[model samples]
Target chain A: MPIHYPNGRRFHETNTKKRSPAPKKISYSNRGMTLEEDLNETNRYYLEHGLAVIHKKPTPVQIVSVDYPKRSAAVIKEAYFKQASTTDFNGVYQGKYIDFEAKETKNKTSFPLSNFHDHQVVHMQKVIEQNGISFVILRFTQTEEIYLLDSRFLISYYQNMDTTRKSIRKSDIEKNGHLIKMGFHPRVDYLKIVDSVYFSN
Target chain B: MPIHYPNGRRFHETNTKKRSPAPKKISYSNRGMTLEEDLNETNRYYLEHGLAVIHKKPTPVQIVSVDYPKRSAAVIKEAYFKQASTTDFNGVYQGKYIDFEAKETKNKTSFPLSNFHDHQVVHMQKVIEQNGISFVILRFTQTEEIYLLDSRFLISYYQNMDTTRKSIRKSDIEKNGHLIKMGFHPRVDYLKIVDSVYFSN
Candidate 1:
């Protein structure tokens, strides 16, 4: 039977289960998690441990058509992805509003400016103006190095891209951003940087 | 050509334009908007005027398969809706974290507890524990009346529902919750209630 939410939207538990397929044989050498997966695990750790209440917003989808069978769950037959109007992750932590975007780049020398969208940058600016904690988590995939850069620096660099360098140099990020150490329990472990940068008096 | 976001997801502006089809002939007397639509417009108004920063989280959808046509946008071929793990609307207001769920009911005597889910109640509890503002906006459609009820009252009522009452009485809501007067510009105008209930220091 189709399970319908209070708002009349149908849900299927099977689809959620199918979202993560069966795990393959473990190989430590080749196995690696994407930045999104790492952040998701970190956020889940925060939530389960009663530390924070952050969550990644679902990818926006412009749903077109739906199929309603007599006895089966409603299936979405047609849809297309939509551009998000704000950052991907946000929540409340220690009486503070937290909002941020995470991105991973393969380039070793610098992070490409094209990784961010104009609307996302503007959204981060608005978040900062509202006195929320706003920043970006950047990971260099090749070096396995991650940094939490303040949105102010990002916005400044993004705005000056035409005049200055097209991409932010690794040295500039190292100077302005805080390096995040990967951990066992919470993989990304970004709250430490947030505490030191935004909360430390 | 299909417009692709930096994350490689395809987007089509036409899809968004299609999401809201051409507005039907205006029926001033009979036209009524859903609570979700009202809140959306209200949030937009707040954002534009820089009064507050809030947004409704996108509906969660589990994508099963996608088809990338040679010269067209990537179409979601198979997908299913998933139950959201938290409240629908959340953001920052005057440097404070804000979170809430909104529901409308036709019940004249009482507000049905069925409108809320267990996870949402728990999420609200977590938000309050983090010192974030949490509440519920409920509408009695029969009388076109709305109230903003604190989540603490809601949680208590929900917990003892089996013994005391299956639903919260309208009289109880009238006494405990703040009545939100509908308005022309923002429609619901629930922020006035938030300011009075939460920030009246």
Candidate 2:
């Protein structure tokens, strides 16, 4: 069996064992964390703290061939990536069906609508129809700002994109979206925003 | 870039095109349907009919190497399967979170507990703790009987395996579990059982 980092990097326990241990470095700011990594860490924190049960769905792959060796594990010989049919992360949060996709863009002013595929948008719509708490975690990488925007707003914007701007303006996001505060323990505390935005009475 | 059947079989468009056109085979009575195939078909039906939004999570894989050629899609050079930490199927139905794992056993007398992993059992416990509906779909292939057993019962049976029987008896399941009726459109009408067991007053 193999383990992978949240960024899809392969983890090598043997390599780690061969290296000389060094003191861990501490950082005050969210400098090198990718949105996926932050979310995975946050979900792990939530799971460990008994706050939520969320997981990033595995990358969809279309396996073409596999080799079953004489005395070893079956090895995937040929495979290709498949476009996901649904959002990346989903699970139960406070007895509610929580579903969302996380995306990051380098744009400073607007988040491009092209970042999401049609199927994902449609899937989010369906989840919302089923009364699931559906949203998107958008990160403006240029400014290191993250926002949780409801899927309802995204779907409405996506549907009317032919006449309007191809991207969502930052001002609109700031007004409509909830900012996710960065933290050390969980890294991206989006659920805190979720509680206020979706759960607050 | 490639398509796949519910059984993880690769779909070859070229091969399919080259084959002589033949009428599709028709069958009844759930003669050869695996539990996974049934669940996948049922989920597709639910999705298409706007009934619910359930999906089987993709098998987790850890890619060790990738070959990105100048042209064409990148192929996975080396990859290994990773053990899943959560149940296979999950989504929202009628404003409720639904999570379950489907399994089929060849044994006629009892359903073995070894079919589930400790992590999966723990995950189901967590789901139940969070007030999410959790269960397992057990199929006795010998008799073609399918039962939807709640996670609470399964967890208790699993945890007390040391002192009691290592498997749940067929009679016990017949008494405690709700039978899932076979169908044509959705194949296995498990949600009907879900509604009666988890939703109905």
Candidate 3:
């Protein structure tokens, strides 16, 4: 796959079109912290700056037993997921509701739709019908590259997985997604994209 | 504590409220489940009908340990809540972002703000600032009367706690809240209130 760059150059995942090497290595020894920790820290920065209001939807759980050991608290003795969620995080930004699913891809060539579940696809469909901005945040774990792909592109590709190409190529993602630049305060400044979409009219 | 109808009749808890009569038989017999069970059943009905999308917020827990038996699901080992949440159920209805806290009060006289947490109050304030509609679903556990009290009212009363009132009086709630007629399905049809607020032109 290829994407037309501003200089009229066709960029490909092959050796001919490699993205510039990542700027630098992060100093923090985040050996065990999952990508979720870094993103949450970044989201906190965005919230403090009034940039966006996003929250990781809590994993839905069905509690079978709760023990009230004391009056002050109730301990969940047993629980399980009642239903799968549509996305990891969602919130309102610039008067428009925003929803998204985030996935980490280890593949070097492309991201597989197998990372997503059917219920998530259905949930995104409902969000789009309700006029909410919906998308998928794909992180290439090895390269640490993150891109926001609109749901329109995602669902289309997801549905055509069987007969179509193996996965979405790097070149195609660069064309459709707004690349999220990693930063110091908030690693992923996603609200900037939300501002560009909803407020920059 | 009272609400007057247009016919100049007063509606008080004593007359309109009906206690879910305690099982006359022994606990060893088929005593059935708690009020929580009935409400859970009702929420299931609502979800099946697409009337609303509300879910019980999972209890925040601190996980310390887990045992991974081969070929079995990963069990939570140990965990604790990082912090308390403000409300119980939050979701979308008729394009209106709705957030709410639910509490069960055995006190037939009134519901107490002590049932709410400081963190929850702060969360509600933030939710309102972000253009989301928020309220509390108060269940008179014995009487089964559920009232939807706007967060605005709750916030005002909360702030005035040190000065004038310590609790939101039952009379004030009756005056402002929209009474939900309990049913078997969708136990609490809160979308009816959302429709009135967001869709009534």
TM-score of every model? 0.86, 0.87, 0.75
DockQ of 1: 0.38
The DockQ assigned to candidate 3 is 0.13
The per-residue C-alpha lDDT of model 2 at residue A165 equals 85
Docking category of candidate 3:
incorrect
Q: How many Å off is the CA of A108 in candidate 3?
A: 2.1
lDDT (Cα, tens digit) per residue for candidate 2, span B42-150: 8989998989999999877767666666657767766666788999999999878899999888789999998899999999999998889999999988778889999
1 against 3, candidate with superior TM-score: 1
lDDT of each: 0.81, 0.80, 0.62
Q: Find the number of clashing residue pairs for candidate 3.
A: 16
Worst 10 residues of 3 chain A by lDDT: A10-19
**Residue-level lDDT for B175 in candidate 1:** 93
Model 3 earns a TM-score of 0.75
Query: Considering summed lDDT, which 10 consecutive residues are worst modelled in model 2 chain B?
Result: B12-21
Docking quality category of candidate 1 according to DockQ thresholds: acceptable
- Tell me model 1's lDDT, rounded to 2 decimals: 0.81
**lDDT of model number 2:** 0.80
* Higher-scoring candidate on DockQ, 2 or 3: 2
Tens digits of per-residue lDDT for model 3 on A36-96?
A: 5556666667666765566766554444444445434444455333345557777656445
Comparing 1 and 2 on TM-score, the stronger one: 2
Please give, for residues A1-201, the per-residue lDDT of candidate 1 as tens digits: 223212222232223322324432222321345577678878988998999999989888888877666566667788877778899999999988999999988789899988899999988888888899999999888778999999999999999988557899999999999999988778889999999999999
Pairs in steric clash, model 1: none
